[model samples]
Target: MPIFIDGHNMRGISPTDLEKIVNSPKDNFGITHLEVFYNESEDKLYCVLDAPDEESVWKHHESFGLKCEFITSVKQIKTAKDLKEEKFQILGEFASQLSHDLRNPLSIIKNSVDMMSIKYKDKLNADIFENFAKMDRSVIRMNMLISDVLNYARTQSLILEKYSISEIIQASLEGIKIPDGIKLVIPEHDFSLKCDGTKLQVVFYNLITNAIQSIGENNSGEIHILCMKKDDIIQIDVQNSGPPIPDEVLPKIFEPLFTTKDHGTGLGLPSCKNIIEQHHGIIRVKNNPTTFTILLPKDVEKLSSITV
Candidate 1:
């Protein structure tokens, strides 16, 4: 068994009520609640549990109708003292190191796949070639997962630059291949803002990719991206003609490591949220057409000065 620490926003739940729930001997997921630390002021709960794996931890929490902000496997339990900031710092460092370590091997696998593709272009049969293509897709997906982890873990300062909304959306779309039966529409109007163009591009890319995935392959869908400037804030909406997000899953969609997809790393939306907040902006989602809206400050320089 491994030790894990999971976090949850307590909402209005009191410590006594939480204790009562945890005291129940419900080992459905083979998870044992060992210790819990509650921050009354912050209304955040940290639970130390003995579980079979991270998935079991998630199931255990889900069984209790609890949404976890994050669930991380820890090697050892340090202290029971209240150290919220330090706890997050430790988790961030662990994620950064883990991602960095995995990239080297991933690169080797990717390069080997490329070489094989070139060398066996003429010799391989159709089935073998298809398998090789699958392998290449897997490598690409793994690389994407690694990038998401690194982006979420590392806290790098923004490189503020002037860029038009149209330009950013265009650059983001260049990397993605829109599947057949899917149509993408971009806003005719453009707005300029001073922000981290690279990070912003990642936000748009994730949103657009999610929209495409939601539409699926067989369905004829349209992805409409709309932009507008209101007062000192600029709003961007990425809407898709896909099934609405389930009511049960909507609230936890932005939480880290929360996903309904089989192969999803569950860090994409969280990373987007982090980047938007870093720019003094907010990212939110709504159903009834499946729209993701982002509101960012029009003048980052002024916002930065005021915050300082």
Candidate 2:
């Protein structure tokens, strides 16, 4: 069995009532509530439990008419108290330092390429000029890879603010150069969401970039972004007219370091998943015409206050 820590907003629920609920018999899902922690001032409750999986924990909470803000899988450290730090924390620190070291040289190379391109444009042959262009692109690609690594390794704090869906999407599109043959359709019915706008921007940027790449250069295609609000959740779908992803590849698309592209770092989708999960939301994909759907809670209070 895996252990999970689930947080809930317990406003208006008394400690006595919560205890009575927790003491009730375990449900048929085989979930065992191991421990409970409550903060009266914050009206926050955290439950440590042993369960089959995250979904099982979700179902267990749903049965109690409670909504979990976030559910995280964790391991209990019984022996080494000093080694309680998470492996990802170490990896994040190392990745930050490594990115800093690598970017210094990368910046130099990029500047050199730009200067050479301007100084030799008239002197170089078409083939040589094309090679310079490729070099410049490679530098840009390397920079993006470094950013992906940092984004995945580090757990960033969300700076929540209210922003319209259309505003965020437009901000994401500013840096991307859509091909001439492709058409982008954005939703006219916009909804405002309180979230980490910068993180959500990264999610949209990666999804749109992937969509454009999937359509391929000089290929005519349409990428449509749709947004709708239903009940307490807001759903957004990014659909692209690209070839269907293979069945085997579909399941692993969000996995880290999994990619079919030769030059891809494979961190884009995984980073997007991490950001969505941090927001206490869900992201899924469907193929027939290749659509990625994201479901986010309309009420930001459902999200845990813990950064990332």
Q: lDDT for each of the candidates?
A: 0.83, 0.81
Candidate RMSDs in Å, in order, are 15.1, 16.0
Clashing pairs in 2: none
Summarize candidate 2's per-residue lDDT along 63-148 as a digit string, tens digits: 76778889888776244544544554676678768886898999999899889989988999999987887787677566655666
Candidate 1 collision pairs: none
Q: Residue 98 of candidate 1: its Cα lDDT? A: 85
Task: Compare the candidates by lDDT and give the number of the best one.
Answer: 1
- Per-candidate TM vs. native? 0.60, 0.58
Off by over 4 Å in 1: 1-91, 101-144, 304-308
